[model samples]
Target: MTAQTTDTVLYRGEDYDLIGLIAAEPITPQDFGMTPAMISTACYRGYFCTYAIEDDRLFLVEMTLRERDGRYLPIGGIQPVADAREATCSYKDLRIPVDYTGSLRLASGFVRECYIHMGYQKASAFETVLDFSLDAGRIVRVHDRSAEAARKRGAFKKHFEENVAWGIQESFDLDMDIW
Candidate 1:
C-alpha cells in the first residue's frame, strides 16, 4: 500500500481538507452501469474515476461542456454544474463560468482525483507513443512506447479495452495541486 497524505480541494459545492492516497486501482466503466466507454469517440475513449465516499456522500467531479463533433466534450473541469444544490463555480480544477445558480461553501472535508498518468497517444508509424505521468508532482515521465508498439501494434477495436490508466494512481496532494 502507498502512503496517504492530507490535502484540501474544491469539489462539487464544497471545499474539503482531507486525506488522499495514490489511486493505483483502475476504474472501469463496467464498474458503472455504462458500457466500456466513459468519454467515447466515433473512434476512441477516456478513463474511469474511482472515489471513496464519506457519510454516504461522495465528491462528484463535473466538467464544463461544449459540443464538438456532434458530441459534448468536457472543456474544463469546473464551471456551472449540479450538486445537492445547483450552482456553477470553479472548485479545484473546475473552470468558472459567467452565469450559474447556486452557492459555494467550504466544507469540513474534501476528496478529489487527479490524473497522474494520462493522454497516452499512439502513433501510426514510427513516432514514439508517449505515456506520461507526473512523478511526486515534480518530475514528469514520458514513456516511449514505440518499441512496445513495434511488438504489439494492432487495430484498436474496443473502447474500454485500450491500454491506459486514468485518474490518480498514487499518493498525491490535492489543494496545492501537488502530485
Candidate 2:
C-alpha cells in the first residue's frame, strides 16, 4: 500500500476508531540527536519518538498505554515522565542518577518529557535515553547498541510512535477534572 492510504485502528473508551498518518517526513536522526546514526538507532530502538500536538507545546511520553474494557491500561511502561514542570526539572536534576546506567541512555542523551495537569495529578513521563558522545562540547554520535535487539523485538513499527503521540494528545484534550 502507498503512504497516502490511511490505516485504521481501534482504541478504547471511545467508539470512533482512530486513524494514523505516517509522518510525511520519516524522523531523521538529526531531528532527535546530533547524527543520523544516533537518530536511526534511537528510532529503531524506541528512543527518539516525536509527535506533534494541536498546541505549540511538545509532549513526550516514556511509555505507551491503551484503553481496554473502559479502563486505562499500560501496554508498555518504561521510564516515567514527571507530572509538572517542577517535577520534570526535578527529574533533570536526578538525570545523572537515572542515567547512571547506560540502559536508558541513547545517543545525545534523552529529552525526557513529564506530563503534568497543573493542580491535578501527574499524567505520565517518558525519557528518550540520551547517550551521545561529546568532543570538545560537540555532539559526536548516538551509540545505542539496542538496534539489533530492538529489531529482534520489532520496535521499529510505526504504530509505536503514533500511539505515543496520540496518548499525550488525549491527555491534553481531556478536562483537568476528568483526570
Instruction: Kindly list the per-residue Cα lDDT of model 1 for residues 3-80, writing each as its tens digit.
Output: 232123333434442322233222222332223222332112233232222332333343221112223223332333
Off by over 4 Å in 1: 1-22, 25-78, 81-128, 155-179
| 1-179 per-residue lDDT for model 2 (tens digits) | 01111111111211110111111222222332222121121122212232211121212222211111222222122233433422110011110101111111221111133223221111122121122333322334444333332233322223224575543444323121111
The clash count of every prediction, one per candidate, is 11, 14
Worst 10 residues of 1 by lDDT: 98-107
Best by lDDT: 1
lDDT measured at residue 146 in model 1 versus the true structure, 0 to 100: 47
TM-score of each: 0.23, 0.17
